[model samples]
Every structure is written in C-alpha cells, then in structure tokens.
Target: MIARLVARTFGLSIAVTVAALVVAYLYGGPAALFVCAILAILEISLSFDNAVMNATVLQRMNAFWQKMFLTVGVLIAVFGMRVLFPLVIVWAVAGLAPAAALDLALNPPAVETADQPSYQTIMVQAHPQIAALGGMFLLLIFLNYAFDEDRRVWGRFVEHWLARLGRVRHAAIIVALAVLLICAQIVDPAHRSSVLTSGVIGILLYLSIQGLTAMFDDDELPDTLDPAVPDPSSTRPAERDRPAHLPVGGKAAFMLFLYLEMLDASFSFDGVIGAFAITSDPILIALGLGFIGAMFVRSITVFLVRAGTLTEYRYLENGAHWAIGALAAVLLVSLKVEVNEVISGLVGVVFIVAAMISSIRANRADARAATQTAAGVSGP
Candidate 1:
C-alpha cells in the first residue's frame, strides 16, 4: 500500500535526481553534485507542508487538471518562478537589461571578493519586498481558512472564535490589512513603502483569484431532497445525496491552476532567497531546488489523493493551514529578525505531526465506542 501510494513519485524523483546530478556535473563537477543534493533535500524538507496543501486543493480537481498540474504546472514552477522570476526581479531592481540580469545570475560575483554588487546582493536587498508579498499572500490563505465559519473540523478554540467573527463583513481582509500595517512598521524605513505596497498587491492578487474562481465556478445544488429523512419543510439534502465533488470545467480548472502556481511561488520566495546562502548559481538552483523538489511535491500530492489520506485524517488540512499561519508569521517577522530555515521547517512539521496524532487518537476512540455499541446491541 505504501509502495503504491508513492510509486508515481518514485519515478519522477529518480528522473529529477539524475537531471540534477548531470546539471551539477556540467556546471561545477563533483562538488556541485553534493551541493545540488543538499539543496534538493532542503527544498523537500521545507515544502512538505506545501505538498499537503497542494493535495488539499488538487484532490478537488479532475484527473485532467491533476495531470496538468504534474506536467504544464511543473514547467511554470521550474522555469517561470525559479528561473525567469529571479531574472525579472534583478532586472527591475538593478535596472539591468534582461540579458545582463541573466548573465549576473549565471555568473554571480563572489560576495567576499567582488568589488561591485552582485545578483545575490541585489536579491538580498529585495528580501523585504519579497517577504512582504509572500507573507501577506500566505497570511490571507490562513485567514480565509480560519474565518471559514462553515468549516466543521478545527484544531483550536481560537480558530472557532475566529470563525465566529467571520460573520462580520470583510473581517478577514480587515484583519489582514491590520497585520500588514503592523509588519510594515517593523521593516526598515527605506523599505516601508515597498513592503506595504507589495503586501497590498498580495491581498489584491488573492482577492482577484478568489473572485475569478467564484465567477467561473458553475456548481449548483440538486433540485430534489433525500427520501431517507423525509420532511415537508426540509430545505437541505443528505450528505450522500449531494454531489461527491464540485465539477471543475476548463475555465475554473484554469483558475485553480493559476491559484496553485501563485501559491507555489509564494512558498518558493523564501527557498529562492535561502538558496543564495548555499550557492547563487541560477542554473544549479533551478536544477536542484526547482526541478527536483517540485517533482517530489507533485508526486506527494498525487499520492495523497490516491491514498485518500485527506479523507482518512480529517484534521490534516487544519494542521496544514496552521503550519501556513506559522510560516506566514515567520516570514513577516523575518523582515526585522533573521530566522533559521531549520526553525521554520521544524515548526511546520510539529503542527502537522500534532494534528496527525490527534486524528489517530480520535479514530481509535471512535472505533472503541462503536465496538461497545455493537456488543450492547448483540447482548440485548
């Protein structure tokens, strides 16, 4: 069962590993291979939560859309965000031409030895803006989940209260704005405007995507009621009678794809910045962190869907969202304070593991109660 769950990912993982090694060899020989391997591991460790979150959404999608995520989606993730996005940033910030930006990325100046500013220097300088955008995006994701009053499963009392407060109009947006304002004050004065603007853009991007999804979505309730629990005034249908899942057509599917890409980009922001700490070679970064890590994530997403893990572990989604909240907070705080990547990764793992344990205990308790009820019925 375990082997089948991860079988698809295994093939892609081997392919990505081979590709990374070959690229590493061509770029900087054996030493580069070791670096690539380490970066790949780092990316995977940091992105396990990302995989879970992806699965949460991806499972809702049709098989065609799921395949698109693995194929076309991978290209967007690897080349679009990992490769071209950095060049675009450098181009915009450093006022370098596209070719020059690419050249700088490919042949980054040595931090200690170079006399002039390099790609890494410029990228680091832009960390405040990057962090703000990614943080705000992630913050909204957490807030949306927290504020979902209809959500039946919850991990904390605060979440329940927050959901209750969701009844207020635009409560999530207001809270997000307030947090963004607080974060802006924590950043350097020079970067204050950039941070605020990027954060607002993040919020706008999220709202825009959500609006688009709502507009494009075509699902509607069934016209009839369930016969099992008949009631003349009943306005609701039984859970089993309702559609198993919302059918996503082409437009809605496309919007979901775009949403996934944006989410991946937000997650990648820190990893991309952190990769500089390892090596500033754009090609190597794409091969090791981008290609290999992304494939593994996609594989894991597929595994989760096939294994029905989300359905089995009811609280797992809550755990992922909680991890996202923690990550968002860390990203925002990182604007003012340096945070270790290990700490960030570990925090996410802790939340997910805790939720998993809670789910396990709940399942066991339910089983014991069922056994008792069955025995009582039989004895009588």
Candidate 2:
C-alpha cells in the first residue's frame, strides 16, 4: 500500500527533487544542496495538515478539475504564492519598484549589518499583515468546518455543540469576525489598521469565492419541490444518481480553483516567511521550498483520494480542521510574540496522529463486536 501510494507521485517527486538539487547546486554548492534538502523536509512537515485538507476538498472535485489542481493549480501555488507573492509584499511595503524588489530578493545584504535592512528583515517586518490575512482566511476555513450543520461526523463534544450552534444564520462568520477583532487588538498599534483591513479583506475573499461558486453551482436543489409535480425527464439519469452536487464546468471549476489557490496561499504564508530563517536567496527558497513542497502536497492529496484514506480514517478531516484552527491561532499570536516553527508543525502532527489512532481503535472495536455477534448467532 505504501509503495502504491509512493508510485503514483514517484516520478514527479523525483523530478522535483532533482530540480531542487540542481538549482541549489547552481546557486551555491554542496552546502546549498543540503540546505535545499532540509528546506524540503521542513516544508513537508509543516504542510501535512494542508495535504489532509486538500484531500477533503479535492475528492469532491471532478476528474478534470482534480488534474487541473495537480497541474495548473500547482504552478500557481509554486510561483504565485511561494515566489511572486513575497516579492510583491516586499515591493509594496518597501516602496521599491518591482526591479529593485527582485534585486533585493536575489541579493540580500549581510544580516548582521545595521546600516541597511536585508530582504529577510523587510519580510519579517511585514509578517503582521501577512499573519492577519492568512490567519483570518484559515480561521474562517476552520470555522466553516466546525459550524457545518450538515456534517454528521464529529470527533469531539465541542464540535457537536458548535454544529448545533451552526443553526444560527452565519454563525461561522460571526465567530470568525469576533476572533479577527480580538486579534486586531493584539497587533502592534503601528500596523493595527493594516492588520484589521487585511483581515476584513480575507473574510470578503472567502465570501466572494463561496458566493460565486454557489451562484454557478448547477446541482443545487430548490428548497422545496412540489410533490405533485413529476420529475423533469430532461434531467439525465446519471445527474440524478449523483449522491452529491460538486462544482463542475468552466465557471464553477474556475471559482473552485480560485478557492484552492487562496487556501494554498494561506497555508504557504508561514512557510514562505519561515524559509528566510534557513536562507535568504529567493531563487533557492523558491526551488527548494516552493517547487518540491507544492508537488508533494499535490501528490499527497492524490494519494489520499486514490487510497480512500479519508473514508477509512473518518475523524482525520475533523483533526485536520482542528489543526488548521490551532495554526490560525498561532499565526495570530505570532503577530504579538514569536512562535517556533517546530511547535507549529508538532501541534498539527499531534492532532492528526491522535485522530488516526482513534479511528484505528474504533475500527478494531467494531470488528470485535461483529465477531462476537456472529458467534452468538451460531449456537454452541
């Protein structure tokens, strides 16, 4: 099973690793290669939660969209978020032209020098705004999952109560807004406006994508169908048989693609900023962290879907969302206090591992009960 899962992404993974090594080698040497390897591992560790969340959504998409996610969607993640986004942030914040921003990224000055700020320094300084936007987006993702009234599966009592509260209209949005407001108060006064604005934009972005998708969603059933009216013969049998309505076609797929990219961007914010701690070279950072990391995430999503891992470990989705919530809180807190990346990664891993263990125990208990019932039916 492990081999089969690896086989699906083996070629792509190998290609990405080779590319990373080559890029690192060209940039520096053997030392650079080792750094690239370390960065790849860090990216993978930090993003396991992202893989689970991606699988939860990717499995709902059609085959074409799934392929698009692995292909076109990955390019956006690698280049758009991991590469261009940072440069753009530096450019905007530092008030430098695009060329100057790129130059600063490619050739960072000495870190110890007090005379001028390095690219890393500038990026670190911009973390508050980045945290605000990414934190709010991620918080909303968690809130939506927790407050989903239709969700029948839950792993905790709090989640069940949250779902019950979900009956209140827009409860998720209300909770997210309250959290954002609280987070804003904790941000530096100098960056307070920027943080709050970015957070509101994050909420708006989520709403816009979701609303647009709903508008284009062809499968949404009417609130009430007249019982007296017969079924429309024009509706295809296959369409009727579909157990769930998924976003399909050009417009809906585009909206879904946008949502996926936004989610990827939110997840990548910490990794992108954190990569500076390892290296200051933008090219090496993109090659090592962006390319390899994005590929592995995509591969994992595909593997989970193919292996039916989500179905097998039912609580895993709940765990991933909880980890997302924790990560969001960490990001928000980091605005006021420095947070260790190791702690962030470990929190997510702990939740996922716990959920997996619980699922395994449940499966075993079910099996044992079934065996006992069968034995009882077969009289001694």
Candidate 3:
C-alpha cells in the first residue's frame, strides 16, 4: 500500500512539472526551454542536501500530513517563493518598477545579461560579500546542530538581553528583526538597506517562517507510528525477539515536510540570487528556472524513493548536512563580500563527495563484518 502511494504521488508530481514546462515552452521559445533546463539543474544541484534534510523529518510523518506536504508545500515553493518572491526582492533592492520587471520577464532581452555585465557584473562583483553571507549562515546552522553549548562573549551585555528575547519562540524572531532594524538605524542610518542588513533580515526571515509553520501546524509532530513498519535488524539473542520498528506518524511526517522546505529555502537562496544575477527578468527566472527546476527536484525526490537511495545512500545524508553548512557559509559571505558561485558550489560538492565516499566505506565495512560473522558460524 505504501509503495503504491509513493508511486502515485511521485507520478502526479512529475505530471504537474511536465505540464508546467510545456506551458512555458508554448509561451516562450527555445530560450525558455534552455533557461528552464539550466534552472532545473541549478535547483537540483542546490537542493540535493535539502531533500535529505526533509527526509529526516518526512520519514517520521503520517500519510495525511505527507500528502498535505507535497500539495501545499509545492504551491508555496513554486508560486510564493519561486515566482513572486524574487520580484518582490528586486523591487525592494533595485527599486525597479515591478511592472517593468514583469515586462522584461515576458519579453527577455535578445542577449543573455551575463554576456553584458553592467548590472549583472556589479552583482557578481559582490561575490565576496555574497559568499560571506552564505558562509556565515551555514556556519551558524552547523554550530547550532553540532554544538550544545551556547556561550556569551560579553559579561551580561544589553545585546545578550535582546538575544534572550530572540529565543522567545516565534515571536522572538520578530523581536530579533526589530532589534536588527534598530541597530541598523543607529549605526548606518544612511545605508540601512546595505547587504549586511539584508543578510540579517534574510536569516531572521528564514527562521521566523520555519518556526511559525511548525508552531501553527498541529500535525507538525505526529503522535503515533504507522502499523505497517518493517522489523528492525537486531543481532543480540534477546534483541532478535524485539517487536517491529514503528513508522512515522502523520504529524511527524508533516513536521518533516516543513523541515525539508525550510532547508530547501536555505539552500536555494544563493541559486535564486545568482540566477537573478544572470537575468533580471522575473518571468524568465520563474519559467526558466522555477518550473523546470521544480520538475527536476520532484524527479530526484521520486528517484530517491524508488531506488531506496535514502536508505542505501545513507552517507548522502551526511554529505547534504555538510553541504547545507557550506551553502550557509557562502550566503553569509555573499552579504559583506563577493564570491563566485563556482566556489560556493565547489565547497558544497566537496563535502557531499566526501560524505558519499564515507557512506560507501561504511557500507563496505558493514558487509565485511557480516560476512566474517557468517563464515565463523558456518565453520564452527
């Protein structure tokens, strides 16, 4: 039953993605197709780590929440974030007329903007700051995960009080933002909209959105596991008689979905901005990169499920975690300095590749151990 459901859900997603691409193709020509393809790859490359992060939560969710996740979750990603979100950003940052951006998207310029690096070049030139933003965000996330200890550098400072206020659940995120706004006001009132402020806002916004969704969703944490779970592997004579492992409940699954989206948002930040750096057209960005990219992600998700990659390729999970960290670091750096996307991609890919090798090594070790035990038992 579970297998059938997985197949159907994945199939539906593929169909939708294809339909979207077809529409974009009909609306625009080969340029649209090319853009879509590039965006799809970019999105997939950026989101590989995101999927594993999601699975960690999704594996724990029940069927109902799982369905809601793919449905509502896709809508938010495709439309809210992918389409309208960038336009909003451009309006805020470039102070360009949204209508003009819309027109540019509908009728993209003959030449790829990257070929003419006036505005795009300037953005790319800020690569160091971009890398800084991404890098810092990733480091913070990694530290939050890897470290248990939260220390204070200053002795009972006022900022610490604000930081404590920042921990007050969902509301704390807003408080943090307000505090950042106040500081920006005091320190650099003239350039409050600088990259530094943008970075802080982006991080805080990401946190706030994720925290709120989890807090609001009742099924974010399920109460019970599915009855159809398979038995867990056990070797101890007494443990061998233990009951089967329980599957994730609906609520848990929902939470997992939320978690995945949050991670996805974090991973996509640079890619989205980088793409905009490539072409300022919102429509082109959405159609070229948004719809097509979404399709690829859906395909990858299905592939992982069918191939049992998540289970078999367990090291991929570790790789993705590290990738997230790398991406975060890239983001933080991008804020204050400039860095190339290639460098960011390289940092993440290195971590993922290392993790993949580690996973393969661990699997081989497990197999060897099992073989040795079998040989000993048979010999005796």
* TM-scores of all predicted structures: 0.91, 0.89, 0.66
Off by over 4 Å in 2: 110-116, 218-243, 378-380
Candidate 2 residue-wise lDDT, 1-380, digit = tens: 78967786667877978978897898789998888888888888989999999888776567888889889999999999878888888888888776887898777765646556778888998998999999999998888888775553445478768878888999989998898888878877999899999999999998999889778665443344323322122143432333544436567777877888888888888888888888877877888778888888888888888888987886798889989998998899998999988888889999999889877877787789889999999968
Predicted candidate 3 versus true structure: per-residue lDDT over 200-268, tens digit per residue: 745664565456655644443345433432212323333234332344544444445655665555566
Using alpha carbons, what is the TM-score of model 2?
0.89
Error of 2 at 91 (Å): 1.0
Residue-level lDDT for 79 in candidate 2: 92
Alpha-carbon local distance difference test for all models: 0.82, 0.82, 0.56
lDDT per residue, candidate 1, 221-278, as tens digits?
A: 2344334422111233432233344546477778888899999998888788888888
Off by over 4 Å in 3: 1-25, 94-101, 104-138, 148-257
Clashing pairs in 2: none
> What is the lDDT for 294 in model 1?
80
TM-score-better candidate, 2 vs 3: 2
Point out where model 1 deviates above 4 Å: 109-115, 219-244
